[model samples]
Target: MTLCLLTITTPSAVEDVIVDWFLEQEDIGDFNSMPAFGHGSHEGKMSVAERVTGRSRKTMFQLHLSLPTVERILAKLKKDFAGTEIHYMMSPLMRAGDLTAYEA
Candidate 1:
C-alpha cells in the first residue's frame, strides 16, 4: 500500500470543520496545522479593490494516510468544494515515523 502526505489550505473560518473531517476518517491520524498566508486575490470581506491589493490569509492542515483514504477524501473535496478556494496537495511519502519503523 502507498502512504501519502496530504496538505490542505483554506480560510481560517473553516479550519475546525476541515480538521474535523480528517478526525472523522478511520484510516487517518496524527495531523498538523498552523496559520498561513497566501498572496492572491479572492472573494471575501474585501471589495474588488481591496481584494486586488490584498493577500488571502488562511490556515494550513497536513496529515498522513493510506492512498485509498486520500483518494476517498479528495474525491469528496473536489466535488463539494467546487468553485471554492480550498486547495490540497498530496506527496508520496518516502519515509515516515521514527527509527523504530519506516515505510516509503
Candidate 2:
C-alpha cells in the first residue's frame, strides 16, 4: 500500500472549511489536529508582538492516508482554497502503529 503522511496548516478562521473537507473524505480512515502558532508576514501588517515576537495562532490538520486518498484531498484543497494562505506537505511513512505490531 502507498502509505504516507499529509499535514496542512492554516489560520484558525479556515478551520470549519478544512474540517468539512476532511469529513467528506471516505477513504481517509483517521486523522488528527493540534493547536499551533508560528511567525509569518503578509501585506506588511504586523502587531507589536507579531513584529517583535513574530508569532501568530494557527491550527494544524494532519492526515495519515494512502497516495490516492492524499491526491484527492489535495485536489479538493486546491480548488476550495485557491489563493488563500495555507501550507501543506506529504512524507513517506516507513512504519506506523504499535511497536510490536508495527505495520509498514
Candidate 3:
C-alpha cells in the first residue's frame, strides 16, 4: 500500500457536512487527518463591489487526509457531493535523494 494525500475543497458553509461525510465512510480506514489550514474568499457587504454586485459567492475550505483506500473514498465523495468541485493528487514516495543528483 502507498501513502496518499487527499485534499478536498468545498463551499465554506457546507465544509462541516463534507468533513462529516468523509469521517463516516468506512473505506477511510484508520488513517485520516484534518486540514492544515482553512482559507477562502467570502461575500462582503463592506466592499464597494458588493454594493454593485447582486449575488453572494460561496466560500471555500480545504482538507487533507492520508489513506490507502483511495477508490472507495472517492466513490463516496462522488455519491454524496455530486455538484461540488473536487481535486486530488496521488504520488508515490521514493528513497531519499533517489530523484536528485546527490551522492549517497
Candidate 4:
C-alpha cells in the first residue's frame, strides 16, 4: 500500500455540491483525515485584487486512498465526475511509518 495526497480544488460557489458528491462515493471510504477550509475576499477587500486572482475562492480537500494503481484511481474519478471540473494532485509517500503514531 502507498500513501498518497489527493488535493481537490473546486469553485467556491459550488463547494457544497462537490463535497456532497465526494462524500457519497462508494470507493472513497473513511478518510484518514478530512478538513474543509474557506478562502475568499474580505468585506473591505478590493475588487481589483480579487479580479487578478486566478480563482476567486477554492476549497481544498485531502484524502488517503489505497489503490492497486494510480491509473485505477484516476479512471474511477473520471467515470464518477464526468462533467465536474475537479483538479487533483497525487504524490507517492516513501514512508508512512506507523498509523498508530499519527492516530488521534
Per-residue C-alpha lDDT of model 2 across residues 1-104, encoded as one tens digit per residue: 87788988887777887788778878766678888876757514445876787777678988878888889888988998998667899999865665788545
* Candidate 3 or 2, higher lDDT: 2
Q: Estimate candidate 1's alpha-carbon lDDT, on a 0 to 1 scale.
A: 0.79
Which candidate achieves the best lDDT against the true structure?
1
Please report how far candidate 4 places residue 18 from its true position, in Å. 1.9
Error of 3 at 45 (Å): 17
Could you give candidate 1's per-residue lDDT for residues 1-104 as a string of tens digits? 79899999888778888778778867777889999876754445544654776766688988887899899989888776676578889999965787767544
- Candidates, ranked, TM-score: 2, 1, 4, 3
lDDT of 4 by residue, 1-104 (tens): 77676666655556676667667777665443234432344322325655566224556676666645445667876887777656678877655545778755
- TM-score for each predicted model, relative to the true structure: 0.75, 0.79, 0.49, 0.58
Give all candidates' CA lDDT scores.
Answer: 0.79, 0.78, 0.50, 0.59
Q: State the lDDT at 96 in candidate 4.
A: 50
lDDT of 3 at 56: 35
Candidate with the larger lDDT of 1 and 4: 1
- Winning model by TM-score: 2
Q: Residue-pair clashes per candidate, as listed?
A: 0, 0, 0, 0
**Candidates, ranked, lDDT:** 1, 2, 4, 3
Clashing pairs in 3: none
Candidate 4 global lDDT = 0.59
After superposition, the stretches of candidate 4 with alpha carbons farther than 4 Å from their true spots are: 31-49, 52-55, 80-83, 94-104
